[model samples]
Target: MRAVIATEPGGPEVLTVTEIADPEIGPGEVLLDVAAAGLNRADLLQRQGFYPPPPGASDVIGMECSGTVAAVGPDVTGWSVGDQACALLAGGGYAERVAVPAGQLMPVPDGVDLVTAAAIPEVAATVWSNVFMVAGLQPQETLLVHGGAGGIGSFAIQLAHQLGSRVVTTAGSADKLAACTALGADVAINYRDQDFVEVVAEQTDGGVDVILDNMGAKYLDRNIDALRTQGRLVIIGMQGGTKAELDINKLLRKRGAVIATNLRGRPVEEKSAICASVVQHVWPLVAEGLVQPIVGRSFPLAEAGAAHAYMESGDHSGKILLTV
Candidate 1:
């Protein structure tokens, strides 16, 4: 199999294409002939040696992929050869083939191409788990999504809108904000020029019922202040700093729930459950054209280094993908 290997950690240049042996399948696993791989922010960190694959996982860096089932492993059932699916991997997605636990495989929805479907798993799971499951965004309430033009935020806006919630999003530029608006955000504010807190307060009557934050510590204080009474805040990334002082008084006064989570390190069964839930609850939305996976761009699998650089450039709105 041809794969992108990160033998040494450094810059994007460290990612190089090479021919490698195919992965061995284990019990309950399925072998996939890779079609497209989703490029994520964590891929950049992994390539730079800041984030290593989980212990005993493949050293390769990629989290999600879409493809055709080539073979089934011992004890795996219900899935047949030639199934069209995508899987979330602990490692090894930047390759021509991957062995994924059958439970981790999700069928691509009707009307979505295999390449565009590659963009679905990770960000969809992340946004649904963070904004809906964790934060419990309710209808008739206000939900704030940060980095609204990005993959997760774009999905967040659409999902919130579908649930009858008013979606507010913050981005860095006018074009990005427009993307969010097109995704069904009720209010889109440019973080580069406006204070999102002020914008939220003005637009939502007071504050939002939920906040999906990526800035972490940098937005913590303001996030608390921007929440409505009994609101919820879910943080999935720390694009800014990691540590920030919290105001317990504000939290208590608002009866807010602040939670932080990451999906990658979760146990297999848990991830499997989330994947199942997605295949059930969200795939229909995709098929119905209510929620579309936004694919920003694609690069050859061998050019993964360049792909990571492009993602880090923050010049694109939506998911960056790699064609295998």
Candidate 2:
């Protein structure tokens, strides 16, 4: 099997596609002949030596993939050889073959193609678990998302909008904001030249009820400012550096809460539950075309390095994929 391996952590140039032994599965797992894999910002972090896979996980960079089952291990149920599926993985999605826990697999949605299904799992699981399950966003509430044109953001926007929340999102450019609006974002703020805090305040009575934030410390203070009383703030990424001062008084006055989370390092049981929630709650929306896969571009598996470069360029509007 050919896999993208990092020769050394530094830049996209470090990634090399080379033949590697096919993975073997244990009980409760299934081996997939990967059709396509999704590229995430975390992959770029791993390539730059900023993030490493959890203990015992494959060193390969990818976190989600769409593929067909080649074999099922002992104790696995409901999946059989030749079944088409997409899976959320801890690692090893950058390879031609990967072993995924049965609980992590989801049947391809009704209208998605094999390669496009690769774009669904991670974004679906992330947005559903964080924005819906964790934050408890309600139909009549308002939600704000950072980086709305990115994979997770695009999905969050669509899902939140369809679920009946008024959605506000931030992107870097006019065109990106327009794209976000087309995807159901009620209000799009250009982060480069606008203050999202003010925008949210003006759009909603006080502020949004929930905020799905990825900027971490940089937005912590303002995120608090942007939230309504009793609001929930879920932070899933730290692209904007770590560590900042928190105003306990502000949080106390609002009676709000902040939750910081990461999907990659979770225990298998938790991941399995999230995957199940995604399938049950989110898949139906996808099947109905109320929410859709947002694939920005795809590269052949061997050209993963170029994919990484493209992602780093920050020009893409949605998920980037590497087709096997």
Candidate 3:
């Protein structure tokens, strides 16, 4: 099998694809002949030596992929050889073959192609678990998503909008803002010029009911200010830095709740539950064409390094993929 690994903890230049032994499946796992893999911000962090895979996980740097099942291990059922599925993984997605816990597999939605299905798992699981399950976003409520042009944000915008939540999002450029609006954002703020806190306030009656934030500490203070009474703020990434002061008095006044979560380090049972929920709740929207996989571009699997460089350039929208 050919797999991608960082030669050293450094930049995109450190990534290299080389021959590696095919992974062996464990009980309750399935071996997939991967068709494509999804590139994520966390992959970049891992390449740069910041984020390591969870204990006992494969060191390869990908988090999600779409593929056909080549074999199933003992104790696994409901899946068989030749089944087409997309999966959530802790690691090893950047390879020709990956062994996945059967519980992490999801059927490809009715209208998505194999390569495109590679782009859906991570973003869908992240957005669905965080925005709907964790924060409990409801119909008629308002939601705000940061980095609206990126994978998670883009899916969040569409899902929230389709589910009847008024969506507000922030992007860096006019074209990106337009794209977000087209995806169902009621208001798209250009983060480079506008104050999102103010725009969110003006768009909603007072503040948003929920905020799906990835900018961590940089947005902490303002995120609190932008919350409606009893609002929930779910922080899933620290793109803007990790530490900041929080105004407890203000949060107390609004009775808001702040939750910080990570999807990759979860136990298999938990991941399985999230995958099940997404298949049940989100896949139908995709099947109905109410939500779609948004893929910006793809590179051959051997060009994983270049793919990393492109994602770091911050010029692409939606998900980037590596086709096997």
lDDT of predicted model 3: 0.96
In candidate 3, what are the lDDT values of residues 1-324, reduced to their tens digit? 999999999988899999999999989999999999999999999999999999989999999999999999999999999999999999999999999999999999999999999999999999999999999999999999999999999999999999999999999999999999999999999999999988877778989999999989999999999999999999999989999998899999999999999999999999999999999999999999999989999999989999999999999999999999
User: lDDT tens digits, residues 194-253, model 1?
Assistant: 998898878877799989988899999999989999999998888888999999988999
TM-score to native of every candidate shown = 0.98, 0.99, 0.99
* Count of clashing residue pairs in every prediction: 0, 0, 0
Estimate, for each residue in 1-324, the C-alpha lDDT of model 2 and write its tens digit.
Answer: 999999998888899999889998999999999999999989999999989999989998899999999999999999999999999999999999999989999999998899999999999999999988899999989999999999999999999999999999999999999999999999999999999998888889989899999899999999999999999999999988899999999999999999999999999899999999999999999999999999999999889999999999999989999999
Candidates in descending TM-score order: 3, 2, 1
Model 2 gets an lDDT of 0.95
Model 3: clashing residue pairs? none
lDDT ranking, best first: 3, 2, 1
lDDT score, candidate 1, position 289: 96
